[model samples]
Target: MLQFLHICNLALLDEVSLDFEAGFTAVTGETGAGKSVLLGALSMLAGNRVDKTIIRGGAEECIVEASLHVAGNKQLAELLDELELPPCEDGVLILRRSLHRKRGGKVQINGALATVTALQQLGEEWIDFHGPGEPQKLFHEKNQLALLDIFAKNSTALEAYQADFDQWRGLWREMENLRTAERLSPEEAEFLQSQINAINEVDPSDESIEQLERDFKRLDNARELGQLSEQAGEGAREAAQAASRVLRAARELAEIDPEADALAGRLDALIIEAEDLSSEYEALASGGDFDPSEAESIAQRMQTWLQIRRKYGPTTEAVRAKRDDLVRKIGSQTNVEGQLIKLEHRAGELEKSLRKQADELRRRRLKGAKDLAAQARELLTKLGFKKADFSIEVETENKLSRHGHSGCRFVFSPNAGQPLMPLNKIASSGETARVMLALKAVLAKADATALLVFDEVDANVGGEIGAAVGRELAALAGDHQVFCVTHLPQVAALARQHFLVEKGQDDSTTTVTICRIDEDKQRRESELARMLGDRDSKSARDHARQLMASV
Candidate 1:
């Protein structure tokens, strides 16, 4: 519900501030008294685009600001959270927009700088306008289907159907991707297989590669290494024999003199270490013969390692990873046909399930459309459409959509014996407004938008029928906060709050002012009397008083 509105330097409204209540509120003025300026200010709050001309004659900017009470609205809270804006405090949300002559405009929500797009999103969840151009919304097939779904209470069933449809779509996309993959040419298949074969033949590993490299190096210089080992062994043996001779001499000295005991112990340790070194060198000298065949095999393996590196990567690890990936790809390619068949069968099954769900939804929509159209037509009579024909037409197609297999259209004939046509193509602005009103009245409990503003809804009607329209709007307020810009005293009299828009001039500058008159009974009655065509007539005042009494 809207709590307050403040407009500054907008068109004829130089500056106007008014508080609003959560019920049917009427704004009344003569045809050219600038009542539409109030609607323009609201439209701006709803994120509608405005030109610089909307700025007052001498002002540089136009500002539209509103405070709305939006507590316990989960969808709204979620949207605000998504937009990263301040949440409503004490159930109040402030939305402000300012238009400048040269700098365009700016929007703010709850003190945070926001975008017009964000305002648009929040506006959908907050207010719904049902005026001249707004009524065309009902002509859209998507909105028409939404209304029918709401009236039918098909949320649970619709959710289930949509979930199934989404699953089917997922499967379909996967199958299509597989089909595309399976279309690979024979050359492509051969290339993948060859890469796998090349990597597998080497079967590379870090330890195996290191060992091969060592073996290759030793075999390549075998003759030199063998001769060097033999010479080192002879030298080590001579050194060991010399150490043994020294050890025997030292032992004899120790036996002769106790002072030589430490020298004798050191000679004993050196003799053992020299003997071990001599044995190790002798083993290397006679280790094994280097065969030419073994040399060739090691060389070939090394060559293969080099080739694999150049082709795939420069490291054994990279080659191994590439080999593994190629194996997986070739495996998938070999089984592509079978996978495609399996997916096709699964998708077919899902399609059958979706068809059944679509049929169920179509049936429910057909029933709901019938009932909804009948209820709206019944209310249309009360809104001055005595011989009007209104119907909700549902056309079922074989193809499927997120909204099921049925398309909905609102068709109307304002006079008897006329062919029913789609609302957008046939109904005039006045007729469309009234039809929207009737529909709103019929679906009051189901419509969740907090604010509903009706403009030009009382067009081309007067007297008891105008009062009937007023009564319908009043009834709608039970479920929504309603604002109607009306020229009829009957409608204004029925409102819980009444605001009067008046145009006045001072020094060639014209301005429009809006103020609440409902607080003062005489002022309200006088406005109503003025609407009745004669504010000072005794009969008109009496009539206005009677109308107020009825409320």
Candidate 2:
């Protein structure tokens, strides 16, 4: 769960830090009280793109940082490993993001530098938000399928199907290439053969390409290499000889002097070392003698390789791969009919395999759909949508999807007599918000993110239903840390923690403050009473006190 969130220099918020625990926390404020500013900061932390204009006035950058206690979540840890991010220390995963006004922002995970993409992946795995633009994205088809997959624990099965899908796609591409080649005119076939023959003709027999390259490097720098080797060799030899001669002159004296004798022995060793070096240097200076004929042949062969590389490569291996592909295509063209038949058969077999996997996916989806609909109906009923009918319906197309041969849609109806229609067709934004909230309640256990955020979940809800919505959120808080930005007092009254985000202006500068309400009963009552449309009224206070007491 997210334990800490810190934001600095973002929009109306100059700086704010909040500590959270495993429960539903409600944020309430006036319309322009920077409530959305907090959500915006959270969005950036989730790896969503941000504009530089969001930086607080007079600040050059904005920063959002979070600390999550992800202990025992092997799945999240494994995901971090897959992204090559630093592992949690003592069950803590730290994510920090900094956005600059004049440059692109930077992301860090556990203090090790990371990419926005990495942060986004982590967000996808651990964060489920139902809010203005982002949270509702969960209603999309892909996310719907993923929710079902998560419920079914279908990672391994999905991976197997994806692998088969890739193979089928590859075969289809190859078959198309073959068919295209078969339709090539005689001149086109001749041109392809010519390109292939050009590479095959440059055979450096008895020598690998690497060996040729090494030889060429040596021969190319031979002059400079020889000069340096000879110069150093001669200098060392002359110095050794001169020292030896000097020691020889003292040899006679060495018979009487112990120092002279020792010095002369050192000179003898030095002279031998110098001679060995000179011999080695001589070989370096004059070796690798390339005959004129062999040099010409090598130069021509290199030119051929370079020509092919320039056209088809950034490297030798790439050109080589392309060469092999061209050869296969040419061969297929020669036996066009036979190759076509083989490819068609292979494609048919792959399709059959893909269909088998698709069947299994369809069956699992149907089962999951039934389970989700049952849960959805019960959850909606709790949230005051007693007549709501929800279903996850799996439908098919003639073609296959990357997900499978089928897709699913959320069918919903707020009234009993109305025919069930697609969620987008009949669901209003507020209805969508409530529906999403109910789903979040249903999937709380299946969702591993640990952090669930709902923005304006009471958009279309009234006091009659606000208590029910609050109860569902409170129930979800037991297993996850949930955050809700709401305007309704009934909803805010149930929060484990309540905060007021107030915006003020002084001398043309806007400031946003997030104040944790006092635990004093009077202070809590006052805040709730304000939400009830009175800050100092007997009737409003009584209503606010009652709402707070119910929780």
Candidate 3:
């Protein structure tokens, strides 16, 4: 249940805080006193779209927030947990929405940033609004079926049906996609196959390309490299021979002087270094004799790698990746006929399974619709529509559809002689309200909507009928919080809590204010009398007093 609401800079409400409770709370005031604005605020809380223009003059934004106690709402708690939203700590769930001019708007649940879609899901679980525009919701086929299912307590069965339908839909999409993929055009097939054949011819390894290029370079310049190697080898041999002669002379002198011995040792080191250089030259010269035929083959292979790189990718790894993709794609298209046959058989099996499950679902709905019609008719009779005929038109299709096998239509007739037609075509907004009221009374225990707001449900209703509606709302409030905006004294007098919306203007600014009517008899009676249109009249006060006592 919604425990509190706060509004700021919205419409003509600069700032307002309302304390709400579980039971019938009547909101009444003169025409154009901003009661509807309060309902608008509630609608926003229910995740409806916001209009920034509703912001009050000179205000940058408008804010509306509500605190709900959700400890008892297992469905809501589970939904919150699933969405990874903030849980209702200590049973308190805070929801807030704000509209801004430049930045649009935002919704927050328990102070965590949230999406309006999440709030809409919450609305589905917690709030049900019935008013001027809401009765039309009952005319929708899905809504009609939902009401019947709620009455039947068939949510689990419906959940199973929905899950299977989702699977069937996904399978249907996959099969279609596979069929489309299996039959490629001739040109597409040729292009991909040609790429595959080319890739197969030159299976380049990522590790060998650079080494092959270096080998090709050396082989291609073989004549120059071999000559250079021979010249270096001869130069090292000559240097070693010359250094040995110098070392021999130095050693002979060293016998005569120790200084000569040090010079001989340096010459001996140069001769040893030259000999090592000659061995490296010989190794280099040996590589220069690589086979020309082998070199030509390597050159041809390098050309193929170059061509593959240009056509497929810059790197051998990239070519390999594309090669695998082409193989799979071409193979799938080439073998399409067999794949299609198998897929078609599987799809047929899934459809048959879906139809059988949907048949059971439809059977349950048809049985539940009977009880729903009977109970609605009974409740409407008590609400002053004794001759109204209510029925649920459940039409079961030959096969499963996107939603289900059967479609539900709510048909209604207010008078005995009238033909039963769609509720939207037959019922006025007032009659729609009564019909909704009857439905709510019947499904109260099965429904999980925590809040119900009625705007002008008393429209075109008076005296006895108005009192009946009030009693029904009060009774309905036994399970959920109910708020009714009205001009009738009977309904106003029945409120366990009463609030009056009043329009006032100071200078050029017009504002709407709401205040709770005190429990004192004089104050409550005075407000009821004002609603009666004669605050000071003795008869009006007496009538108000009588209405209060009846409650």
For lDDT, the strongest prediction is 1
Clashes of 2: 1
- Candidate 3 TM-score, C-alpha based: 0.80
Clashing pairs for model 3 are: none
The 0-to-1 C-alpha lDDT of every candidate, in the order given, reads 0.87, 0.82, 0.84
Runs off by more than 4 Å, candidate 2? 71-91, 100-106, 112-118, 152-157, 181-340, 416-421, 425-427, 504-510, 518-521, 538-549
As for TM-score, the candidate ahead, 1 or 2, is 1
Which window of 10 residues has the lowest lDDT sum in candidate 3?
131-140
Which pairs clash (backbone N, Cα, C closer than 3 Å) in model 2? Answer: 126-449
Give the Å shift of residue 214 in candidate 1: 7.0
lDDT of 1: 0.87
Reference-based TM-score of each model:
0.89, 0.68, 0.80
Clashes of each: 0, 1, 0
RMSD (Cα, Å) of model 3: 4.8
Tens digit of lDDT per residue, candidate 2, span 1-551?
A: 88899999989899989987778899999887889887887788788888889998899999999999999989889989998888999999899999998888999999999999888888876677776566554568887788887776777788998998898788778777767653667898799889888877764233566777776787787788889989978987887788778867778778888778887787788888888888888887877556778777777777787787789876767767887898876676677678768878987898898888888888888898899889989989877788889998888878887888878888889888988887666546667778888887777776666788888788877687988888888988987888899989989999999888998888978899997883668877998899889989999999998998888
Off by over 4 Å in 3: 1-16, 30-34, 40-127, 133-136, 181-191, 243-277, 459-467, 502-513, 529-551
